[model samples]
Target: MTKDQLLEMVRDSTQVMTLRQKLALVAMLSMPAMIAQLSSVVMQIIDASMLGHLGTHEAAAVGLVSTTCWLFGGVISGLATGFYVQVAHKIGANDAKRARSIVRQGISCGLAFSACITLVGLLIAPHLPVWLGAEEAIRGNATLYFSIVALAMPLLMMNSLAAGSLRCSGNVKTPSALGVMMCVLDVLFNFLFIFVLDMGVLGAALGTWAAYFITMVLMMYFLVAHDRNLRFSLDKVQKFKPHWDTLSNVLKIGTPISLERGVMSGAQVAISGIIAPMGSVAIAANTFGVNVESLCYMPGYGVAEAATTLVGQSMGAKRQELMRSFAWISVMLGMAIMALMGVVMWVFAPEMMAIVTSDADVIRLGTEVLRIEAWAEPGFAAAIVTYSVFVGAGRTMGSSVLNLASIWGVRLTLALLLAPTMGLHGVWIAMAIELTFRGIAFLLRLKFRLKIRE
Candidate 1:
């Protein structure tokens, strides 16, 4: 079916959809998103490969602060969800005007919020490497790289807001397409800055920043002028001011998710600290391993995106059964796909690691870690899609709580216990176990909270 036709099907709440039909819809929405996610993985692979060639120090520098970058990016993305979730509900209710209004308010609030994040990130960038216990050798480049990322927070936030809004309004193709394009641009810019200008780690950050800037503009244009359900009229004066009700709603939905991201990304930063003392080889290995492994799980994220949109629309329609069905179907499908990917990762672990780096020691270490992490993909997929399902259904607070508990209570605790003896392998083992536990927890919650009458 065409995108419009599939979207129409999604918006139609009256019809009872068959299982095959539900699967088809999920798959359709997921394919583009999956492609987009894979492109992002490809971008990361290219980045790692380029930096790897430069020398282990350059890769280690960017890797050092990458978690902090995620911390900042995650907060903005969670905030965007606050706005876009409302839009999804409104669209489901066929209230295009209300959706557009939320879109306007989202822009203002998101930018302001992101500006604050930028300030905080900038303040911390200089000291972050030292705080993480990075070796003196890589600290300067790490600081510079993070500082650039901090400065680009607003652009990243805008991209997150625009992309989330479009996806929620059944315009996933636009964001997905732009995501692929952004990957290409990122590669080109990285090439120019790193090889041509010899900017090294700084070049990697600038390349990403430039790509975000360009993509943010295109995404905003599509969101405002092109979307059928969400387009706002420029001819009529539209208020960009935030209404108290809308802002309150955003906070209510967004806060828990944002806090969860904060806690989770904070934990990641802490984990980076744990890895830092292991020296440059371990640092580079962890970075390359994570990038290579992302190829396996990014499809799950793509499916999670589809889950959020589907469940949000279903919740908006007040079709409880449909919402729950979509949640289960999406979760199961994601698990299956990632399970397959896990096998691929297991068989080609060395090759995957080698794609991003030529350092024999780094590749061997990375290969081992990727194999360790591969077994967790099915569970990881479950947690990923289930969390999105919960978010779509506006059940973020409880799920977020459980999620935080799992990472901190289970993952971090295990990582601490294992790292000294087992090293990077210990850290990944902790991750795999925590992901499995998290998956089980989320699955139980979904079943209990969304049970349909027999």
Candidate 2:
């Protein structure tokens, strides 16, 4: 095939693609993202292992402040979605000029929002460890880690916008490559700062921040200088002012997503609080369980990224049938891929846990939770990708409502009711059931709600 033929194969819309062609496109879009997601997970596992070696308290210290990372990251994801989704639609509709305009406006809005996040995060860092109910022994280290990481919010948000915009333009490989590079950089910096320099938890935080800083620079360079469809131009630099209309649409789609993520992350902090009182071993295992379970679900997230781009662009092009078709295909692909990862988790839970921690209790408890969570992966896939579909169509409210409801109403309530008797196992079972419920709920909406609208 010629270079142009390959581009056509990779970039053609679902309106012209057969089912097999669509699946091939899905793999092309998703596989790089999947590897990127896995690379991110591997970096976190490496961090956990190094922290675990430092002592249970060190691991617990990082864990105490970890959910805050999710909370912040969730908001950044929502913010980037607003602008990038618009770009995806424009690309689909062949309005490359408008798409580029939206990209410019998006960077402005993202940076503005990052400023707000930075101010709030810094002000609260000292009190965050206390608020999370972390034990006194690890509170200082936790505070330091939180502060340093919080300072990097702007770099992280910038990277999110740059990378997301590039992906939405159908150039996934560049961002994926940079993501893997960042992960590797994170470990190298972590090794030097954490062990050779003996900075402990603070070193870990600095290392991650440095990686974000460097990656953000390169990502922006690629978006501005090299992207095939949406490269930025200094002459085309729109005034650094709010595009009120664009901002309004972004808010309409992003607010619920932001709210959904905020609630989910907040609920996690609460659950961590519950785990905190159970002692360091419980805390260590809970933290370790979370990082381990994430590996199995990363593929689902990878495909979800593809769903958002494909569906958003299709909707932009006014091809409702194509949009719906891409949505279903993405959902099924995510489900199939994650289901296999789930099986792997069930079989190798102990080995995975061992790589993160040597504590027998930590390994055993983490393994049990992974097994409980394994059965829920298919359902988890549905929720992840379907929600991406909703975001692509700028129909985020319903899915966000469902996610907030399930995570809070089902997961939190059950964890509370069962934790006293069943402990960490109870928490995992609650998570598993809630995921299944969420998946079923998303599919119902996709079939009945989206179908009727169509």
The clash count of every prediction, one per candidate, is 0, 0
Candidate 2 Cα outliers beyond 4 Å, as residue runs:
1-15, 234-237, 451-454
TM-scores of all models? 0.98, 0.96
Q: Output the number of the TM-score-best candidate.
A: 1
- lDDT against the true structure, per candidate, is 0.91, 0.87
> Which prediction has the highest lDDT against the true structure?
1
List CA RMSD, all candidates. 1.7, 2.0
Model 1 misplacement above 4 A = 451-454
**Residue 107 deviation, candidate 1, in Å?**
0.6
Q: At residue 28, what lDDT does model 2 achieve?
A: 82
Estimate, for each residue in 371-437, the C-alpha lDDT of model 2 and write its tens digit.
9999999999999999998988889888998999999999999999999999988988999999999
User: Candidate 1 residues 16-134, lDDT tens each?
Assistant: 77888888889988999999999999999999999999999999999999999998888988899899999988888788889999999999988898899999988988899999999
Q: List clashing residue pairs in candidate 2.
A: none
lDDT of model 1, residue 142: 96
